[model samples]
Target: MYGAETWRTTTTTIKKVQIFINSCLRKILNIHWPDTISNSLLWERTNQLPAEEGIRKRRWKWIGYTFRKSSNCIARQALTWNPEGKR
Candidate 1:
């Protein structure tokens, strides 16, 4: 059995560790994407280019979550549209 003093020290150490871990997790989840210096001028440059080239340049990459949700939505729609098992 731990003495009273030892029990108090151990509890304090555990609380400190928990606080440090919670702070780290908050920092990791709140990460922001940095903007480039030319980001502000992108609109002007795109406007001067041809329509097809401008559209290509304006395309943004999708994250994994976006793709997963899109696929799930498509599957649900397909199932709803196809009542029979033909699909």
Candidate 2:
């Protein structure tokens, strides 16, 4: 998630990230093979946020940061830019 702030996320991407995180958490918790844990429980135990929420937070935080930058910033302009185009 290092550059997640610039990612164009979709359902599949988010789900893949979540699955990877869940597997890592399970390994870290030594819950393997016969052991099982619900996703909600795992999140609760680790105080973790889902991929979607985490990425969304990161994106929003980045957006806010960009907004706080000088008006001439390219990132800030990109956020407020509404191109005159058609679908």
Best-fitting candidate, measured by TM-score? 2
Model 2: colliding residue pairs: none
Model 1 agreement with the true structure over 1-87: per-residue lDDT tens digits? 122222323456655644454444445445334633232234343343323332333332222323456545864355346466675
Write down the TM-score of every candidate.
Answer: 0.25, 0.90
Worst 10 residues of 1 by lDDT: 1-10
Off by over 4 Å in 1: 1-9, 31-87
Backbone collision tally, model 2? 0
Candidate 2 lowest-lDDT run of ten: 78-87
TM-score, predicted candidate 1 vs. hidden true structure: 0.25
How do the residues 1-87 of candidate 2 rate in per-residue lDDT, one tens digit apiece?
Answer: 899989999999999999999999999999997889899999999999988999999999998899999989988899899989798
